[model samples]
Target chain A: MAELRKDYILDQYVIIAQERAKRPSQFSRSPPTPSSDKDCPLCPHNEHMIPGVLEQVGDGRGGWLMRAIPNKFAAVGQEGSAALSTHDPLFVHGLALGEHEVIIDTPHHDMEFEDLSVEHIERLLQFYAHRARVVESKPHVRYTALFKNRGEEAGASISHSHAQIIGLSVFPPAVARLFDRAYDYALRNESCPFCDVIRREKHSKRLIFINKTFVCIAPFASRFPFEAWILPLRHVPAMDKLRKEEFSDFAHMLRKVLRRLGTLGVPPYNLVFYNDERQGMFHFHVQVLPRLAKWAGFEHEVSVPINPVPPESASSFYREG
Target chain B: MAELRKDYILDQYVIIAQERAKRPSQFSRSPPTPSSDKDCPLCPHNEHMIPGVLEQVGDGRGGWLMRAIPNKFAAVGQEGSAALSTHDPLFVHGLALGEHEVIIDTPHHDMEFEDLSVEHIERLLQFYAHRARVVESKPHVRYTALFKNRGEEAGASISHSHAQIIGLSVFPPAVARLFDRAYDYALRNESCPFCDVIRREKHSKRLIFINKTFVCIAPFASRFPFEAWILPLRHVPAMDKLRKEEFSDFAHMLRKVLRRLGTLGVPPYNLVFYNDERQGMFHFHVQVLPRLAKWAGFEHEVSVPINPVPPESASSFYREG
Candidate 1:
């Protein structure tokens, strides 16, 4: 379904399926060690390891299916005012304010997202929406990033099924650029660009899975091998706007795509939720970037990634048994 | 030496050494295995393994100091025309036209860049400039990227010491954006922003090593821990413009800083050369990014990286015996 796709508004290009240098089998690595429940801090009886629980979803058996707690070693803190100041023309900075929290997705220390049941995943999605709303409500919070780092290679310090929500006082430049590009596209096209993308990709070769509410596809301009994007058919600006009924479909789509990705040796990957608190003409979606390859010097300097696996081939692998 | 610094023109911000999350000692990793010369394709006697040598520097001992050859598995090819075309509004692509070549830095398979003599490194630098100029002479080529992938974590496929040059028909979006920002700064300040940076940072805490011709500093807003930028004292638009006398100082500065970086167990890193082929109002420099930590979901999504080690602390480490 996908070919080389340029960024809708930017000059960035990802040369898809034109020339694949490596296949999926070439990316397999040694399996990661799973943490035992006895010493795992995220396990059920180790609540003392964390500062305090911010929220939780009870399992109706005196246990919690999910819990939200502040990250013990937070990257950003609410210690200082968010106002930016300049030391000089070259040195400008603001306090690393706002909040960083973790949502324990399951009680089982060794469980992964693909192992969780659809109903359990749906509840997790609901929790994500609820907590995102809570964090965005903070006065200093300007942008909220909800994402999961699955394994060691994906930057997860603790080997547990969990996700993190970082509330930033400053609007991230990448998201700002996205907003600018989307606004410009809307002005020119008279429609949501993402909606148009869905309409076009749903019938394309890169389509992996499509349901009534959500559609998953290997993005034409995938930066990484097997990179996939899951988008809602309806124009949802942020996770908090999704209706109660939409959670199940979204959860199912996420779980299915992730399970397919498991075919790649359950590779370490990042699942990122792109949501705008400002509710601009942004399309909220989840991007799954598999850490199958390391980005080297060219990628960093040039900023254009050469994806070795074409989206069509990646989609075929995802569609395989 | 470093503090929170913003991009000269962009809204991007990098929080410098405000938090000391982990020390340099904490970044120690297992030593990398050096490939034996007998089996290394880039070894002195394995010239036949590569397609053809585009250029080589004689050591004057019936051997080669450095050799450039086409990459066997090039990411882009010169078979197709460089014209960009769009299949649809969403599927725009162009031929990945240009060249990808590797420079065998040394015949000694076990050697690292830090182990090379300044004179030898200077020769390699000369070779880099020569190849870049040759590549840019092609009618379709618009950009040239010269870089080194030191270890596996830094995305080096072979254990042998080497560097790569990628010539592209299209200008990279990141570099283009950088030019735009620099251009804006010039328009407003009537001077190059990088020249101002050099002037401001010459005696700053972030200064690592400086010589008559080149100065190396830990950038105030580094994305990676211990990230360093090596720049010429005089504003040079590209490597080809470097005066012959400047190469010695540049080589020495690179070697000394890299040796300092070796104190952290010689952590895998990427050395990227930012050269503008168009010879616009740009400052040429080399960026060294140590791969000590993995970039997780938040970094990928927000674009604002949370650097655990401050550049000031990094500068101190680099300055230590």
Candidate 2:
């Protein structure tokens, strides 16, 4: 039997498939195979293989620590054909007119995020905010997405540690739905829904870690086991709005969470950033979802997930014995 | 470069990632390793392993040809704790109160849908409709989902040709969004949006097969490579409402489509049925989605797919020389 759980605030539903409950040991898969560095285009000395570098961060010894470059095979190029702007009743297409850039997090090819130091992670965060600002400034670009796919199972074709930033001509539907929900809640309750979540989560067993600047918790209706969320204590609108102190605190909390996930031998994870829809209508947060199970026909059709492990168990796991 | 395509009528969007376009050969993964028949619970004579048989179809000789049994590890069981009915400010949960059953399409362990005869397929459809009616009769069960996961990659753990019927207490969000769209379109145009889609698709190059009772086409905004849809020529509200003649025609069309897909070496696929939402406001259809690519972080966050192959190419492949 399963339990149909609803998110504390959002309209998201998760079917806790207790009947198919999976233990942590069941999630252990073979470690990712390391691709040879000689043939890797993202490697340090092979910079010439890429079209060109967009940005680079210094390691303070006249060496580059991280670099941003155009994805050799861009999903949406900066210079594509003009947008068709078709509004046909039966068939519609538009030029994927946007910038798709890759941010190589480290020069060391095999270094994952958890292996990076806090200072290095902070520099990476700075680069993300910088590129986000640049993309958000583009005309007709309504939304920008910054995400990371960690391992091969999570869709990383390259073995190198990197994240992607994609600019969109329209606000994404997923974020738009959340914006609408938050706006509706604010109109009725005169408060931010996520702020209320943080307050209430303090009393729940789902709280994983909390600090002065950030709080991490396995969400009430977690779609996946060990699915955790990190939110700022302050009512921030977007990642770019984080001040120096806030960024430092965020980096610390993020590193701690990733390290905890590593202890469980779960590294193939995805991280997505959600900012307000440029109107400060919703709170900014980061969702870390582990790709433990493959979705079948039922999950795709219903948009409701059937999670095996409950968030209560995940939270307790994060808080060690 | 990539292109962004919008669905003909729905508010869905897909980014056609041409740069990552994969040929059919790239999708040829290892077939599922069949579990031995002796241990397979869904196999004939092993029916005692299940909780209890709900329905069965007999061959002319009186032995069972097909059977319907309660899923041993049910996602949503009939006998669970009661519904929580709680609408908490920050925590909500409901009893996953519903029925889940498996319709074993064949007694053979290695049988696939494309290999089944038309008559056998018709029996499976009949069993689906029967179980659907039984579920709908239950109080609080708002909708029933009938879906098939055909291969391992498509999330089928067992190598048996079977389909699942899950009764949902609330209208799923995916369908709810479609219903809202259809209702809004009806209010504005005085017609169902899907009807207009069928009318317009006739003039396009995406049509794959058409008959007196059904039409199959690669959807305009296909989320996956080789994604196709089958709609009734006559406006039908629900699958259960499908008359005997229509059911036969559907089974024939479905058989042809699966055979066509098999020719392309596409073995893993997910099929979902869309009914009238029990509101009689939307047109009924079946969507056939091939599991060709793995959805990464960007897709999960934005609800915008990045399809490698466009629908035009898929349509041509289905209509091969």
Candidate 3:
């Protein structure tokens, strides 16, 4: 029998249909074609291919270990007026005014995210925090999104290990909804909903990993087959607020989950960081969504995903040798 | 420069970033592997492979033109209890008790949806309407989703030309949101928002095809590159409410838009029909979404799509010889 599960905080729901489930091995695909260093823009010698560098993390080797640069094909930029205009009650338009930047996670062209050491991953997290703060401080910026897309299927045009930061002039509707839900939950229950989720899931079958600072769990309403959420045990509202110890734990937990995911042919996935600086009640987290299935008409039409694998099963897979 | 556009009725928004746009010709992919009739279950002589036929449309040749059967690997079934259970505030769940069926669109193995004649397409639409009515009449079914996935990338596991009808026990969150927005809009303006959309887009530059009964247009806030919507001229809330002439015009319009999409190497796409039996003010329509680009980290992070091809450009491409 199929079960419908609701998100902990949001009104979102997903159908967990175990009867239609397939083994993790059945979801693997041929590896993405590797990119060579000869023309890879993010490679150490090819840094000139990218535009202006916004930030860089220096290594002891008198060179940068990572670099942040403006996206050559930015979806949103600072060149336009950010004013909203209404041509009619039915037609609304505005400039997508803000910034888009790419953070090259490593100088090596062949290094995958999961292969990075915990210290290296921690530095990358710090870089993401720094960039988020910088982008959020911009005039008219309302929200900043940080995410990493691995593999071609996951929408990475470039195969280099990297992440993106986008500053938006307006709060994205979905992100705004999350904040609204959190605020309402806090007002009603006098506590953060995500904090409650961490407490409830810490010992549940869906729990994947836990550390002193962070806990990873397969959400009850998993949208994808092996989707995992890494949340801080403490009530941290934004990436910039993360203490050094928290970052280390987050890095370790993330790497453990990603390494386990890699055992399944390193399937393409997206790592999305959610935070809201304006909403103090918001509990920031990172969602690792494996692109194991294509979202067809049903998902687009109804916005209710039918996840074949139960999160409990996925947790077991992650915990397996 | 990138511009943000809002959906006419919903709070949804999309970024039209033409600066990163690709030409329609550039979006083509290799054709999908054709399925042979010998092993294709939906082929004319392979009816025995499917368990039971729920409905069939006669072809006047002592055979059927199309058929609807229960999905063998159904996501939901009628066996389970439909009662909701709350383990805690953080974990709410219920049995997904409903129906899943597949409507094989044609008896021929090689015919693509665009290759079907307008009359044949009309019969297919009529069959869809019949199945929808039957499914929606089931007890506890709150929503019926009708959609077709044309290729593997669009989530079609089989190579046959077929559409799926899922009768869900709960109103999908996204579909429910659409109804809520429409109801709110009607209350504020005393007019159906979709009806207003038809009036406004009939002469807009985004208009693709218009007839007396139906009109097709590239929506202003198209999430996909070549997204098109087909709406009735009248405020018809459900499929059963569509008049004969409206069905004819809709078939013509849908065939035309799909044929145009087919010219672009028949890139994988989804055709979704939106209707509500309970919401009288709901003006139903069909959305044709071309899966030309992959939704990566940015999209998953904020739920805001960055469409490379503007609707106006897509409209011009559809209108071209």
Candidate 4:
């Protein structure tokens, strides 16, 4: 082989991984769909079985506020669940190990974030804020990540109008990176990188949307095609931190970003919240990935993506809107 | 809105971002293509631009081997090269940031990783090892990430067979996480967690591939759908630390892994390397990913993925070979 090896930061040397973590942190495997046309628990008639369904605007019955319930197939083990092994970090031999929940935002089954009204979105934001606070307080929960998958391309299997939250004692390897950086950044920069990002997007150009309390824009360096960021113009760390008055603007900006993507003709989408608000190195930013393009080796290996449609272009489109 | 603020790690909240930095990185603010075309750098270009394309057999010409080069359009900026910037970090106003370099493998232009030969795959491995050493030697380089993107859906602009190496002064936020865990794991266990993983995978029934020098399998706790790990049966810590005799066996194992994938069906894929061979957190390993899926927020936001297909099933499919 080239008698070659990789160089580590500590000046140590070892054989380069001919690939990335040949381990399982990759997120792109899909199971085959069952032929049976079973009723999806989150679907129509099964509504009552869920925690509760809310209607705000147009739920066919009325506008749906949002639905909160115990996720049927939660990744995290549920209350009284007993199939998992012990939660030992030293010995990671256990069930997937954590809590998984589904938050059905709308009952229509076909409606997406882009289709939600401003009022609906505002109510959804309220739910997100409330749930985040509640989830984070749960005992044994070290990290709470809330997210959504929009189309089949984006890995959405249920195809329901909803978001999900996960509470875990152990932070996955991915989140650990952010925590490390945020700690370091805070030590060095004396502030959060994301907070700084919010400021720059506010006073500067590239402003996609600016409501009373939120600003949306295409990031300076988007790693994907037509990627965007929705930040609280006021610089709140977590999605749960928005004020009651600010929730409307934050939700408004989120919808604005999604609506703009609809106009952009992107396919499925995924949203990730880097819960590390940044003691300094961390940026409390929401990476809104429009499924406009696929990610292959270069991206997975290097942790950087070659976004063809630069973020600025998307920002400009938002400016027009 | 719920008077409930989401709490993230690091005490640094959103308030600081409002005052300091707020500018989105930077972009050309242009949209070049909204459609796909066949003429892409990522496409197989056997005789067109590639002169000495490596091959697996057929007098080293027919079966395509691995190839690499400087990316025509890199995402991260290059040092001393003017990248879009108007700020400072450690006295430098703008970093020579942005990713660079591109590695093309497979010459069929129409062929993907599944179509390449085993030795051809080995040559690709040889290339990665060499590049890691080369990039690490560069001055001002803080981190070098090696990754691949297979299909257009995977964020690849070019259709040619290729991988890339992006050198960064600021180690990407994702990678830093491994180092932290390694440190903590080492401190707690008095050894490396990867070492623990190696020992555990070996002892457990979860093990997949085991040669005289390497072990490949689905991790006991995989966070993604088909995430797989390729590790040396033994641990030397960093990539450059690999001994002389182990190269060929390592190469053979890597080749075998890909060769078996062809049996799984032609799927888009990516090969990512953590270069975690640092004293602080270097754990030499390769991540082989069949670009078969997408990150639907759960893996990103929740640190968990609903991996419906267990590793045992995936292993059984490829293990026979």
Name the best candidate (by DockQ). 3
DockQ of each: 0.57, 0.69, 0.88, 0.19
Per-residue accuracy of model 2 over B1-321 as CA lDDT, tens digit each: 688887766767888888878765665666555568887888876767778888888887978888888888888867655566675655678778787888888888877887889888877887787777787778868778888998776888877788888888867777788788888877888987888888878668989888778888888889988898999877888877778878888898888888877765647899988766478878889999888787888988898888888788888877781
Write the residue-wise lDDT of candidate 3 on A100-177 in tens digits: 999999988899998999999999999998898899889878899999999877898898899999999988899888
Expressed as tens digits, the lDDT of each residue in B42-127 for candidate 1 is 88788688788888888898888899999887877877677778657667787787888999898888888899999999989999
Candidate 3 lDDT by residue in tens digits, B13-78:
899997999888898778877877898778778768888898898889899999999998888878
User: Candidate 3, which segments miss by more than 4 Å at Cα?
Assistant: none
- Judged by DockQ cut-offs, the docking class of candidate 4 is incorrect
The list of candidate 1 runs beyond 4 A from truth reads: A1-4, A17-20, B1-4
Q: Which ten residues in a row have the lowest lDDT in candidate 4 chain A?
A: A1-10
In candidate 2, what are the lDDT values of residues A1-321, reduced to their tens digit? 578887765667889988788766676666666678897788888878899988898778988988889877777867655556666654677778787889999988878887899988887887888887887888867788889998866777887889998888867777787788888888889988899898888678999988888888899899977899999888888888888887888888888888877766646889998866379767889999888777888988887888888888888877772
Candidate 1: tens digits of C-alpha lDDT, residues A164-250? 998888888887888888878888989888999998988999899988889999887888888999999999898878887788899
Q: Please give the distance, in angstroms, between residue B178's alpha carbon in candidate 1 and its true position after superposition.
A: 0.5
The better candidate by DockQ, 1 or 4, is 1
TM-score of chain A of 2: 0.94
Name model 2 segments beyond 4 Å from true: A79-87, B79-87, B264-266
Per-residue lDDT tens digits for candidate 4, residues B1-321, read 000111111111010111111121111123223333255544443246433332222336554345555654444445464332324331122333534566666545666554566556555666776776677667656778877765555556566566777766555444565566567667877877777777877766557688788888776544333457788766665555666546666667766777666444434556777675344356688877765545677654543444444455556545764
Residue A38's lDDT within candidate 1 is: 83
